[model samples]
Target: MNGSIKWINGSATLSPIKFIAKIDNRLYDLNHFDRDDFNEEVLELDNLELALNLSVSLYTPISFLELSNIAKIVDDNNLDYKKVDIFALRDIRTDKNFNTILNINNFPESIRKYLTLKTLPLKSIELITTFSKSLQDFLNGFFISNISISYQKAKIFIDNIAIQKEALEGVKYIDGFEFADRKTSTHIEIDNALIAINSKIFPMSISTDDNFESGKLKISFYVDKVNSYDKFIDILNSNDKDIRTLIEFLKGHDLGL
Candidate 1:
């Protein structure tokens, strides 16, 4: 089908084109084009306020040649078309080559002057970092409600004796013990919990390396005395072997078990 743009409100459709000549203002939707139909002909929007209901896919096939020609048209006409909504471009995937085309094309001096463009479903993380550093700055300053923490995994050799001391001194109550810095695939375990506990009161006798290197980090926690630490270990052993799980498990056992 030939691409067409229209405005809709609730169940009503507004006039397809609305122009205010005095202010050089024109309003119309620009999202009716399919990828196969996107060409220089679409750039004829010189003196109009445009609204687009489409996603980002419309800009995928746009070539540099078309962009240059459009830029020239906007420059020669001295168009006063402000506020262009190209929100249709958001549907395009970030990994596609079209993204590079869009960024390079839209920044021409002439095209930028007459058009205030809005893109939909903004770019992804890697794309922002790769395409525009300014975008990264803007995103970093923007506040987000949810935050994710990626853990690093590494083979951590712990001096069981030292851990006992750190646990006894660094932590207030010692109901359970966990090693957050340890690797997941390693089959290491605290063979003697009671010996580790007794050694906590004495001087540091065990020597071991604490450095670990991996993409995931461990976060073991001590559970309450009422809860069985052995059972917690068993549960963790049965799962993905992440230290965070143990910490979370202990956190859930708040009854001082």
Candidate 2:
């Protein structure tokens, strides 16, 4: 989770906040937690009330001067302004000044659980897409971990495969042995399975992580083909039908496509 969205004051309608010598103490009380856990089995997202205290910072020439030369910039108007981008002296950063809560409405069940609940990774895709848009709009910028492709192996972990094993019970393989006719552990759940989902817009492969217990079902997007955040959001919001599905998924009530 190490990325920041850089935003600047472009619209005149958006007023630039004035520099504050001291910040309010109430801002310190609010916690900055994006994910919340209820024991090991149950997981949920925090900030339902959405009391996010965003700190403010403004880069200026005055904040970049040293204490000994503070009066020089204020008294002399001929000073070079190119150094405005560099902070040579005192820090002008402020603490969290205020909090804001957006109207995300009521979502059923824990979002944390639903995302990795053994789907084709579509739920997690929608979650990240919508989350990025909301956070980018709320704060001038937002930050999160980067999700990239891992091509070390084609297949990852898989749990119970009774359903799949049954479906392909009598299926023949390239070698000659049948699915049920195998005398030894075939390890079909790990090496081979029809779980990878291919799409024209975004090609993705979902599998369970080997770290977690085999009994506890989980979803891992370790080998995601989507490269960038903007690209992932674009893939999900490419059409009106997908957009509606994302909205319903966020509400945690949709049956899914």
Candidate 3:
């Protein structure tokens, strides 16, 4: 449970609201059934479903739920879940264009650039862990991409994350291979990163952003910036030579409940 858990053989996505409601109902039932068993809040569950839906509805097109299913597998199976999480990792970009990033139409022109990682189906929860680390590492390091940055206000200063400075001399995860002419670090991978915002956390992933990037880690927390199911798994194994597998956790393994 502490190490990597490869749950899916291919990519999949879950409805966040359903997930939230499911877990919420699960937690409520857990307490309701055991109210007489323990009076000390034996299982702590946070009701962030309504709040998140408020925040989420502002962004994506969410469907109306006819009803929310109650979760019982964990309780029924007697699984000990210390935490349950709601996570989101979003890359809020005004533009959605990757034509400049990688020219799939003409590979020959980009051949001079170091070849990027193969799109391996995720092997583990790396979708959440690895991707997040990569994004953090990328910004922390002096990495480059085909795209350039331009600000309406060039004078704007960044309140950057603190770094040891000395660590910069060492190689970073996103630091690409060194060529005779220069070094290359293409693509920003935010694989399997656990992200937290206040009491909420999630993987938004490639597990590579696999923040579950969209589901729960342990009832624990994680995140990646990108959103949506199809995109999540695509990025995770997008690097591994083995071809990445599994986008989100399989429902069959959700707490074994």
Candidate 4:
């Protein structure tokens, strides 16, 4: 039998090619392939398409800057096509901000400048007390309104949180807060009152024990920052006596104190 042909539909025509080709002047049969042959080659392409669709569903659209980068890469590499379909090119551009985590150590200066100049809500606080004064200044320049202080280690975490609160005192620009405790064996109820009182000082949540074990407290606060669902900021700025009273009341009731 003749070799099997596969047709690829292009812009205005259908291009057909033999599924299998002869090599080294030897005749090769294409149609006699087994299931393993299809699995080794054809299945991978189908899986790749599935994966791409999944990614498209998971991430948002790309930024204009990223698109420019793609164009530059295409040109620099001397890609086969001079132009690509806008939608196809867009699909190739993964959203960089999607699930992005802006930590004290990893916050990008370019992003901060762009957001700050535009007065955008794309920036957040990464409250790390261990940073140098220069780094702290650099982060504070972003005009972020919310900060997340991670309480990872048992010993120094709370102390760091106190330091962050003191440092950010009367700083009106940053208004939101979040904290994480990585110690699983500890019960949140035991220290929930302390955390709630602290939360009053800044818009914050104490993610400890349960949250840490479930992996819900990811380092990525991008979504939290941009969405502005942080009521904790207001809570933090509230009167300390009022917050303490509320915590005491909650503790008396045996609720999430």
Candidate 5:
């Protein structure tokens, strides 16, 4: 609600493609049927089977070649940037069978920086794929913010949704906490083991022939860089203690769907 740019929570249309990603509470209900639907349901439930996920969904989709070109352009313009990836369960309370797809000892510094005590399990996803938004206009705002997902390494994400819901219920409007009850669809790009191109968000709906996987994760804080980029930077630089606490609490509440 308060940021540099306006925040658009859910939508069926975006620049990259014409699909939707919706977040809601339906108890693993499927918008469709089959493996993809099951996967999406699990993702909506917080990537239970997968265990963990961390991704950045830009407004537009960017190809790997484009990323290379941008990196070159940034270099040509003398900008600072870092690319990294990590392999581990970054943030979860328990350990079921979650394991990193790669060896952490060989991870890039950019990815290793996130390694902390709480991130013992190895299962993460990262990428620099394009967003539906034009690269020139990325500063405007994000359809969705960068997100990280994890719970119990060995535990299924769906099993804990109720716990998160109960926690949210107990804290709603308490000490400045609240909940939203609306369904929305959004487009996003993720670079986990698999890459999702022209992916859309929607409520649990009819299944499609394409093997696409998506979820409805509760997201907060829409960063608006277009209108007040400086203000956004100031907010980040300020690092208000309350903001940090709020973020932690939001993560704790987990994905409401």
Candidate 6:
């Protein structure tokens, strides 16, 4: 009950455009939720359809300054409408094992009665309902007293090969032909540490936070279809890791790292 959830993936899609001003990254224990203090913004617009896919990895408690800085950065950016989709990978840590307790099976008596006429497996008994209502119900059922959101870090991958190629062509010093049909990758390093390892083969923008210094890691993939939570869960629950652990795990299995 007092450990991290490892990772949590979520997405929000809107028909009429909506804008976000702040994120409530607080963690609450059983029976205690700071709903009044939570700050979130949503607006109905007639311009565009927007969808946001997010994955978070936590390491430590996120401070108010950090969240404010993030909000400032977003507000300052001049974002325009385009048909591009963003795929991102994140690493997050929590102060407690909130996700483990977010299972319907934890309420076996209620679930059994809810599905008395059906013989579906426990794993298939998903509760994809309204976010607020579902969360409130879960908290009430589990007797959660308090929750605190810790450190959160994410890396976003933008798939814009056409735009990249076009930009490359405008560079007079560089020969566009050299990049023609050739896969390119960008590597990001900080203080001699490889933070992001990008590959044209997989074609994603990969990033991590300070937690990379530790052995814990997370990688994510993006799919085009809607309601891809199941796919994300499948991948998250399957074989995935940071570069170092991944190599070590593979090597231990008699496979080349």
Question: Largest TM-score belongs to which candidate?
Answer: 1
Candidate 3 lDDT, 62-90, residue by residue in tens: 11110001012212333322221111222
**TM-score (all chains, Cα) for each model:** 0.20, 0.17, 0.17, 0.18, 0.14, 0.15
Score residue 110 of candidate 4 by CA lDDT: 42
Per-candidate alpha-carbon RMSD to the true structure? 19.1, 25.7, 27.4, 19.6, 28.8, 26.1
Off by over 4 Å in 5: 1-102, 125-257
- The clash count of every prediction, one per candidate, is 23, 2, 59, 7, 35, 26
Q: What tens-digit string does per-residue lDDT give for candidate 4 at 141-209?
A: 433432232212212332444456555445333334334454443345536654655454443443344
Q: Residue-wise lDDT of candidate 5 within 1-257, one digit each (tens)?
A: 01011112123122322222323432321222111312232333332111111122332332222233333333443433222111121231222211122222233332232232123223322111111113112211111121132324312322222224434332312222223422232212112211211122111112222323232322223345553545544554454453445435334434222
Q: Candidate 2 regions off by >4 Å?
A: 1-175, 181-201, 211-226, 237-257
Q: What TM-score does structure 2 among the candidates reach? A: 0.17
User: How well does model 6 score by local distance difference test?
Assistant: 0.28
Worst 10 residues of 4 by lDDT: 5-14
On residues 88-149, what C-alpha lDDT tens digit does candidate 1 reach at each position? 23233222433342353344332222112212122321133252333322222221211121
Ranking by lDDT: 4, 1, 6, 5, 3, 2
lDDT of 6 by residue, 1-257 (tens): 12112121122122232223122332221111112333433422222212111211121222222222222222333222121112111111221211211333233333223322223321222321112333324322322221121111000001122224344332332212232333322112221223333342133323444434443334556666763657656544442454455446434533222
Could you tell me the lDDT of residue 80 within candidate 3?
Answer: 27
Best by lDDT: 4
**Which ranges of candidate 3 are over 4 A from the true structure?**
1-46, 60-128, 131-139, 143-169, 172-257
Q: What is the lDDT of residue 36 in candidate 5?
A: 30
lDDT tens readout by residue for model 2, 134-179: 3222211111111121211101111112223344333332322223
Q: How much is 106 displaced in model 2, in angstroms?
A: 71
Model 5 poorest ten-residue lDDT run: 1-10
